[model samples]
Target: MIRLTGITKQYATKGGMREILKGIDLTIKPGDHVGILGRNGAGKSTLVRVIGGAEPPSSGTVERSMSVSWPLAFTGGFHSRLTGIDNLRFICRIYGVNFDERLAFVKDFSELGSYLYEPVGVYSSGMRARLAFAISMTIDFDCYLIDEVMAVGDDSFRERCKVELFEKRKEKAMLIVSHSHRYLKGTCNRFLLFRDGAITEYEDFEEVYAEYKLLLEEPQKF
Candidate 1:
């Protein structure tokens, strides 16, 4: 289980201190699959970062009782100077997983081929995203945090990801942040809408999705 209490985040910008999150409280259970939706600049990414512990909230307590994977497609966790293979080995070591055992899986899943031997810095954005997704799958986590970049790669690769994550790891908890309504509807059981630096939970996916579309069509009202 993961619980966030009164979370708030502020960043100093040229315009002054900007509050990205304004008091968010959320909880995720063992089998929950949640989809988060928001317009551009709605602080969706920042909220996910805070939940994943990649960024700290200004004021809040995060209680994580289960193992959590880093946000999927997050390239910042990798060392640019290290080769993709080296980075995978390092991560495996940190997680106390056998690198040798997971090496083939990551290699096959990423499909980077010879590029896996090259420095991660040299890889394109899509390549990096593929590597990140592969690495995330190699490690076992109770809950997975997925950002928008899960849409990486071609249609075939995306379908592969869906099969691996949604079908193969059907029991794992997931928090997905994406603008793709179809993907969210297919994968998630619940929905979270980010608006005015806060999140509104909805049990009915269709209803909330309609509201989400409405907001997109008329952003000024939101």
Candidate 2:
């Protein structure tokens, strides 16, 4: 089980001090699939970062029963000048794992083909996302924290992602961030809406999604 208690995150904006998360409390059991939704600057990314341990919350605690996967994005840790193959080996070295097996998996799953030998700095954003997803999947984790990575995949890869992530990995907990309602509804079993520096859990995704859409349509009211 993953439990977050009294979590609060504050940021210093030019205008004034802004509270991103105000006393968030949530529990995610094993096998839970959760989608996090919010408008821009609503602190959805911040919440995911805090839970991923990339940033510490201003207050409160996040408790987890199992190891959590890092955010699925190639922008972090990956050296731009390094080739994908080299980076794969590098990541394996960091984890002290045998790269021979997992490296092949990442190579094949990324579908970069011969391009995997090229430096990542020359790769497009879509290519970077694919490599990130491939590496993350090859790594073993009890829970996953994703942020906008799903949107970068192509149609076929997206379908494969649905099968592997939502179907095969149903036993693991997941917290995904995406603006695509179709993707969210198709994968997540529950929803969490972030707004006004707070987080709210909902059983009905459509209801919370509607409220979020309203907030977007009328930003002045929110």
Candidate 3:
């Protein structure tokens, strides 16, 4: 189970201190599939990061009973100087897993065959996403956090991922952040709307989408 009580995050801005999240309270249990939706800068990423334990909140508590998988962004966290295979080995070492035994799985699943030996700095965005997604899926965790990752891959690859990862990991809790309401409706059982630095769980996807559409139509009103 995961719970956030009175959670808030403040950032130091050029103008002044800006609060990204203001008094968020949420609870998620095992087997729960949650979709987080919001406009840009609505604190969606901040809330996910805090819950994933990557960042701390300003003045609240985030409690979790399960280990969280890393966020699914292909950012520059991996060293650019090392090869893709080398970085995968490094990640395994960080988790205290034997690299030799996992090498085959990583190579086959990443489909980077020769490119795995090349520096990650040389790979394109899609390649990086494939490598990161493959490696992250290998580890078993109690919860998974996916942040707009499936939108990158081709249709076939996306379907494969949907089956292999999302469908296979039905027992674990999941928090997915995406702008596509259709995807969210199919993937998650619950929906959250983030607006004005607050988060709330909606009764259904329609309710959430209605507000989301309204916000998109009139940004100032929402």
Model 3, span 1-222: residue lDDT tens: 899999999999898999999999999899899999989888898998999999999999999888888886444577888998888888898888878767787787678889999998999888887788777876778889988878877777677778767778877899999998678988888899988898778868898999888877764531
| lDDT of every predicted structure (CA atoms) | 0.89, 0.84, 0.84
- What shift in Å separates residue 47 of candidate 1 from its native position after superposition? 1.3
Candidate 3 structure, TM-score to reference = 0.95
Candidate 1: segments with Cα more than 4 A from true spot: 219-222
lDDT of 1 by residue, 1-222 (tens): 999999999999998998889999999999899999988888898988888888888999899998888887677889999999999999988889999889899889899999999999999988898898899888889999888866788887888888899999989999998888788988899899988899999998898899898888874632
Return the TM-score for candidate 1, rounded to 2 decimals. Answer: 0.92
Estimate the overall C-alpha local distance difference test score of candidate 2. Answer: 0.84
Considering lDDT, where higher is better, how would the candidates rank from best to worst? Answer: 1, 3, 2
Off by over 4 Å in 3: 220-222
Candidate 2's displacement at residue 60, Å, is 0.6
Instruction: Give the per-residue Cα lDDT of candidate 1 at 23.
Output: 95
Clashes of 2: 0
lDDT of 3 at 167: 77
Model 1 residue 23 distance off true place after TM-score fit, in angstroms: 1.2
Instruction: Output the worst ten-in-a-row residue range by lDDT, candidate 2.
Output: 213-222
| C-alpha RMSD values across all candidates | 1.9, 1.7, 1.6
